[model samples]
Target: MTSGPAIYGNFTIDDLVYPNGSTRWGVPGGSAVYAAMGALLWTKVSSIVAPLGADYPITLLDKRIDLSRCRSIPKTMRNWGLYEEDGRRHFISRNESRDWTYFSPALADAASGYQAAAHIAPLPFEATKQLIEELRAGGTKSISLDMDDHDLLGNRSLKKMMELVSTVDLFMPSQQDVLALFPGKGPLEAMHQLRSLVPEVALIAIKCGAGGTIAHLAGSEEYLRIPAVHVEVIDQTGAGDAFCGGVLGSLARQGDLLEALLCGAVSASFCIEGMGFSSLLEATGEAANSRLERLRQRVERAPCK
Candidate 1:
C-alpha cells in the first residue's frame, strides 16, 4: 500500500463536563490528534505541529505519529466542552486570555517543503490562512481545512473566510457552523451561499451530525448527501475532526473524492461509538475497509443525482 500524505495540526487538552456532574479532566484531545488517529488507520502521519505544555499527555498519542517538528510552548490549547442534558454543547476556552499563537519561524520551517497533501485543523482564521499560505508556498499539492465554530462565530468576516476557502482544496464545516456562518438559510441554501462566496473551492463538505454529510463538489449542481451510519452514541467530541482527517488522508493516498467521503463517514462512525479517541483507537484498517465497502454499496444503490 502507498504511504499516506503528510498531515499537520495542533493537539489540545480537553476538559469534558457531562450533565451527570462528572468531569474528565485534562484528556488528550484536539483536531490534530483526532485527525492524526484517523489518518494513521490508513497511512503514516508525517508530523503534528502542536503547542505542548508540560501538562499535556504525550503518552496518549500513538507512537506511529511523527512529532519531531512539534513545539514545546509554555501553554497548550485547553478548552472545556460542556455537555448539557438538553442536548446542547458549549465550548469554553480555559486559556482564553493566554496567547495561543503557534506561528513562528520554526513552525513555518517545519511545515515547509511538503509535497504531499496536508490537513489544517481548526484554529483562528488568520492563523489558518497563514499556515495554508506557508504550505502552499512550500509546494504542497493539496490542502484541506476544518472550520471551527469558534472561528466562525468570532470572526464573522465573510471576506476573510472566502479568502481562506479559495486557497484550500477542501473545506469541511459542521452543520452548526454552516448555519451560524449564514443565518436565515437552510443547510442547502447555506452550502449554496458558501459556494457562491468561494466558487473556486474544489469541494465543500457540510458535516451534519447524526443526519449524515452533504458534499458539493465544484461544478456539480446538486449536493451529495451521505446517510449517517447507525451506532450507539457515546461522545461526539472529535467526530468532525476525524472525518476531516479521514477524507484528506484518503484523498492523499487514493485520490478519489467519493472514496474519501466514505472513509470520512466510517471514521466518524468509529469516533461516536466511544468517548474521545477510544473507539477510534481500537478500530482496525480491515474493519474500516469493510465499513467503507458497505458505505460504497449504499451510495451506489442510491447514486447522488
Candidate 2:
C-alpha cells in the first residue's frame, strides 16, 4: 500500500537521564520508537509491529502507537535508562529488550505495501526468522536490519543469522558492533571484510556515534562517508535507529539508494541533537526537509572533495 499503511519493527524502553545535569531537550526513546516516528514524519501513516509492557503508559501508546501492526509479545516493553555526560551517553539499565515471541503473523496486515525493517538488537534468532517469514507472507518489498552493540553470536546461531541477512536487503550496525564482530581490523578494512559475511546484501551502514557514518555496498570501490551533524548532543541512544528509519522511508519514497543514504545522514544528524524520538516527532516533514536542505547547503560549502 503506497499510502494505505506502513510497519516499523523493533520497540524498546528508553529512559534518558543526565549524569552531569539537565539538557535543553529530552524525551523517551528507543531504536524502534525513533525510527517508527521518523518514518511517520514522511510516510503519511504507518503501524508499529512491536510489543510493550502492560504498564507502558497507555497515554503515550495512545498518542504514538497505531496498534494495527502491533504484536503482543513477551515482556513487550523495554526497561532501559540512559545517562549522559558531556555529550557522551551510557545505558545504565536494560532488560528483556527484544521480546518478539511468535513464529508468524497471526493476522496479515491489511495493506499493500510493507517496508519491513527490524532493529536486530538481538531479537531471538528464531523470532527474527519467523518475523521475516511473516513479512514475506505480507509481501514486504524492502527489509533493513540493524545489529546493535552485542556479540554477533550471542542471541543467534552464526549460520542461521547469516542466512537471515542474505534474505534481507539492507544490513547495518554501529561501528562499535563491527569492531566487536571482527576485532583488530581497521574500520575501512573491516567494512571490506564484511563482504565475506553478507555477499547478497545491498547496503551496510556503519554508524559512528557522535562522529559520522559510512555506507559500503557490494562492488563499490570506496566507502561513502557522511559526516555527523554537529550539535549539543543530549543523548545518543536511538540515533542509529533514526538513520535506518530515514533510509527505509526515503528509499521507499524516491527509489534512490544514494538519495536515501543522504536522507538517513540528515535524519541522523537530527536524531542526535535530542534525547530520543521526541525531537524527531516534534519536527514536521517540512521542517525536517528544510533542516536537511540547510545541512545540504552546508555540505556544499565545505571544501570540495
Candidate 3:
C-alpha cells in the first residue's frame, strides 16, 4: 500500500437544474472529481482513477489531483441532474455511450496496483463488487463503499447489500438508502439494524442531507451525530460524494473517525456554497480548518439508544 488513496468513479458533464429554477450547463462534475476535491482539502496526495474523454475539460480540475491512472476515452459520460423544491433529485443520462461509464476488467486490473486506500464511489452493483474485490486482492490498506439508490431499489437484495457491506472497512450510505434497506424506519433505527446485520463493517455512516450524518463504529455502543456546518446552499450536487471523500481523507491523515466526520461536514459545507465545485475548489486547507474549528464546537456525541 502507498501513501494516498485513489478514488474511482465515472467522469461526467452535468447539466444541473436547481430547485430555484436556475440552470447551469456543461458543469464539470462526477463522484471522482468531487471526492478528490474533498480529499485534497485534507491531503494533497489524492489520485483519481476514472474514465475521462476528450469532451471533458481537464483543465478545470485542480493540479494537485493526480490523473495518471485515469483511463482516456473518446467521449465522456454526460447527465442531467434535475432537482425539486423538496430536495429530491433525479439523474437522466444525456449520452448514448453508457458502456464507458464503468471500468473494463483490464482497466480494473491496471488500477489494482495503485496500492494505498481506495474509495469506490457509487457504481452499478456488480461493478462496485468487482472493484472492491480487486482492490482487496491488490492489498489496499482500506476500502470504502458508497451505495447507489438504483442499486438498492433494483435487483440488489438486502442479503446481497449486507454481503457487500461486510467486505469493506467503511460503508457509507445515504439516509434514503438506509430507508430503502429498512422500510418504514428512521435512519438511526436503520443504522442500528445495519450494524447488527453486517457486524464486520468497521464503520457505517448514514448521511442525512440537512440533518447531518449519523455514524457508528464497530465495537462502540454510541453513535456520533455530526451536524452539518451551516452554509449558504447554492448547488448541492456532489455534497455526499465530497463527504465520503472527506471522511477517507481525514481518516488517512487524522486516523480518527470522529475527526474525519467533522472534516466531511466542513467539506460538504464548502461544496454547496457555489455552483458545482467552485466554492470547494477555491477553498484552501487553512480555510477548511478554520471552518472545522468552529464546527467542532457544534458536534454532539451521544450513545446509541
Candidate 4:
C-alpha cells in the first residue's frame, strides 16, 4: 500500500473506440476518463491505473486530469471497436494495451495519494486485487467493481476474476453485458445465476440503459428497479460507468445508498444527452443534485397505480 488516500479505478483499454461514419461505431473510447470524472464528483481525489502504448500519454498523469492518483503503462498499441444497434452496443477489442508488469502499489501512490474510496472497472482479477490491496493498505475500504472485464461465462476463463468479486463491496455491470456474458432467462434468472457465481458480492446492479437499473443485495430480493430520468439520450457510452461512479462516489462521500444510486441514475440519464461522458464531465455536483432532485420528482410524480 502507498500509505495515502486516493479514489481510483483500474481498466483495460485496447484503443479509443466509439461511433463513427454512417454506422454507430466505437473510435477512441475513454473508460478511465469517464470513470475518473464520475468518481471525482463524490470522492475528493481520484486516480487511474491502466496500460497504454507509447502514444499513451505518460504526461497524462500530471495534465488534463486531476486524479489524486494515476498511472498509464506502455504496451503494444491498438484501438477498441464498438458496434451499436438501437442504442445498444458491443465491443470487438483487439490489442488490449496494458502491461501488468508495471502496475504496482508504489506507482498508484505516486500518482494520486491521500484520497478516499476507489472504483475498479474493466480490469481483471489480479489488477483489481492489487489495487484494492493497495488502497486498503492506505486505510481505505469499500471498493466498487464493474464486472465487464471478467468474461464470466466463457469456458470458465474468468475463474480468477470471479474469485476477486468476493473482495469488492459493490458489484456493478451493465444489464446488456451481464446478459451477453451469461445468456439465459430474464433479469431474475440472470440475478440468480450471478448470485450462484459470486455469492460473496454484497450487491449486484445491472444498468438497464434508458430503463435505469435493477439491483439486489444485502438479502434484498425485491429487485430494486430505479428507472432513468426521461431525457434526450445522445451517446450512451459512459452511462454504466457513471452509474457505478455515482453510486460508489455518493456512498463514499455521503453514506447514502439511495441518494448515491439516484445520483448514479441521473448521471447516466444525463450521459444519454451527449456523446461519451460530455454531460458528466461538464456538470458539477450542484447541477447533478438539481437534476437529481428534478428526476426524483418525476419518479414520484409518475402515475398509474
What Cα-based lDDT does every candidate model obtain? Answer: 0.76, 0.58, 0.82, 0.59
109 in model 4: Cα distance from truth in Å? 6.1
Top-down lDDT ranking? 3, 1, 4, 2
What is the Cα root-mean-square deviation between model 3 and the actual structure?
Answer: 2.0
Off by over 4 Å in 3: 1-3, 100-112
Which ten-residue region of model 2 has the weakest summed lDDT? 296-305
Model 2, 39-108: lDDT tens digits are: 5654554455554444444355325445555555554344445454434344433445432433123334
> Candidate 2: which stretches are off by over 4 Å?
1-10, 15-27, 58-65, 72-76, 82-122, 151-160, 294-305
Write model 3 residue lDDT over 1-305, tens digit each, in one string.
13377888878888888877889888889888898888888986788887778788889888888888777777778888999876667777765755543432234543545656788888877777878877877778788888778778887678988998899999988887777788889888898899889887888999998899998988997888889888888788999999998989988887887888899888898999998888888998789999999988887767877
TM agreement with the true structure for every prediction? 0.90, 0.77, 0.94, 0.75
lDDT of 4 by residue, 1-305 (tens): 23122334433333333455443333233556566556656555555544444444334332334533444445433435464554556544453433333433344452355445666666544555677776667656677877653355444454555677777778887776676666755655676677778876777777778666767765554556677888885667667776776677677778766677777787676666776555665677787778778766543212211
Clashes of each: 0, 4, 1, 20
Error of model 1, residue 91, in angstroms = 2.2
Better of 1 and 4 by TM-score: 1
Q: How does model 3 score by TM-score?
A: 0.94
Residue 43 displacement in candidate 1 (angstroms): 1.8
